[model samples]
Target: MSNEVVLRGRIVTGSMDIADGVIAADAGRVTYSGPASEYRGKAGPATDNILLPGLVDLHCHGANGSDFSDGSADGARSAARYLHSRGTTTLLASLVTGSPANLVRNLSVLRTLTAEGLIAGSHLEGPFLAAGQCGAHDPSLLLEPDPALVTELLEAAGPSLASMTLAAELPGASGLVELLAPRGIIPSLGHTAAHTAAAAGFLEHAAAALSAPSNPTGRFRPTVTHLFNAMPALHHRSPGPVSASLSAARAGNAVVELIADGVHLAPETVKLVFDLVGAENIALVTDSMAATGLQDGAYQLGSLAVTVDHGVARVDSTGAIAGGTATLLDVVRTTVAAGVPLQDAVLSATAVPAAVLGLSSQAGDLRAGLPADVVVVGPGLTLAGVLRRGEWVAALAPTA
Candidate 1:
């Protein structure tokens, strides 16, 4: 008996495109992915649908009325199920600013979920952030970067701490980056008011530290977390963090995460970033919270009051735009609709994010020998079916 599953559709891998294609998997790993006419293995039912590699999101707080900061196992699992159903098979559970004790407790919950394969890992977006640019994060909870606190959080999170967002201009920011870079934890720069020189200096130091021969993690590439959101815009004269990040990405030393949800960025801005930096240097993230996949209403985002009205989530107290309500799939669709090429948008949503978290070889693209995480979508990018590990996640199966 052959444990093989084949899906035929208009296929779009992170790097390749096939009009009439067949993707065959054996024992939960893709064995072949290419043109159906060229396939030598047994073929399954075929359909004139669109097939895509499952999306990978680097920064997501929660979805489906479940928040990762809730510190509840059931809530975390519910979020995972909802995201997976939406074709996001790989996601990092993001946490917002909170007390050290509360953050540690939430990390424990995320750790269990990550160990159970419910999520990729935890993303701490964080207590070590600048209050001036905290966005929807709780200003009271924001703290200056401290190497000791980072060490404590990492010890608590164990191997489940995938990444952290810190203000690069803070007092202990460099120390935290140097400490975490070699340990395989991605040190993302965000929630800052750093000038161009300060921000560029941070990246230079981080690049040097991560590339050192003695570093256990090889070639660590730090990311600009939710670029242009919490940080200052790229002014012609001031430049700021956004400019430095763009320079680093263009130099192939960094990758930038963009929340392409229309509410977070203007369509022209999104298109401009794509054109300037190219898709390979960008990862489209949702940066979503519990309000995602829900109707417009009040919600909580890490101890902050959030309200969603007409699909835009915002802080109730300050009216500050909160985390996004869109999913990674929605972000991809929005990016493509905003003039980015379809393939480029898809890669930013898929492969680029996977590469950010060091999961490129395992989950990003539709390549042979990788886990069979695939998605079937309609013309408008609406998900019709999803498969994780070669097994259908939703009720819709391929029809003959």
Candidate 2:
């Protein structure tokens, strides 16, 4: 709690290696992560939890009874702390379908927070999507993507905008991807009925549109958020967008978001995902709603009311999956128990998502200049501890 704190625990972010050691940090970045004998600074103990990079959540709406779209700085900070405690230190504030005016208002607040480093910008998931696939999003707000409207959103979102979820199959969506990608705002694919033909068409268009020599600066890639949930089920006859996402990753051009909460996808299917796309291509995500890390009950995802029962969040009207109430660590445990190696599971939750988001060199691995955002889980896959900027945030410390 003082100055120049060094943490001691099992370090597991190395390449196919794990070690019991100390991690040193000053201010907010990692100073060193290695054996205690190598740390040359004031030391503190990192217990029960082993130290690893802070979990990067690529798809999560909210948790701790707070919605990022609820429009409150305090509430947003509360969600950040809740996610921080659960091993996520950085998150793109995800929003649901809303009026054009409401979306603008939410993005305005997000801009201020991101400027002050309170949150990680915003992910606009609506005002543009497929109504049939809109699980918990407002049906009234769904519409086709207009590049002009998206440009307006980009202006309102300012520079900190991280991602925008849309159906690649939409008419103007590919053009929107072209426009937004150049601004450093990631374009995510979701809430669509884009089957195989549509998915392939969208990807082809997206790749061409976004990577065109005209938009040489965009450097943005297509993404499929919350795979297997908002999108259709994989099939032997018609794989649709699912197959497209898998193929894009195989072709080295896309990243697919996996909720990994078991409810969204079968435990065994996860192995299939790894087998087809490889764990490095998978970004383990929570896609958690406000019910995450809290008791199950009724909750709101944006304006739509949803129910969380038995720890599963679902849409009441149509029984469509609403979101999740689990953290990246929870998803990691679920996948590890399902047969994924611990290192690979951790990579999916940590480095994999970071890489997909284009933050691998800056925040994913334990290297010089990377933020000291880290967590620690014990030998049996229990969350032993966590740290943000080298400060002990949460853990089940050794009682003895």
Best-fitting candidate, measured by TM-score?
1
Q: Write one digit per residue (lDDT tens) for candidate 2, span 256-318.
A: 888888888888988788778887778888888888877877888888778888998877777
- Model 1 ranges with Cα > 4 A deviation: 42-46, 213-219, 395-400
TM-score of 2: 0.90
Worst 10 residues of 2 by lDDT: 391-400
Q: What's the TM-score of every candidate structure?
A: 0.96, 0.90
Give the clashing pairs for model 1: none
- What tens-digit string does per-residue lDDT give for candidate 1 at 178-286? 8888777888889999999888888777777777666553337888898899998788889999999999988878889999999999989999988888999999999
RMSD per candidate (Å) reads: 3.1, 3.6
Give the Å shift of residue 169 in candidate 1: 0.9
By lDDT, who's the top model here?
A: 1
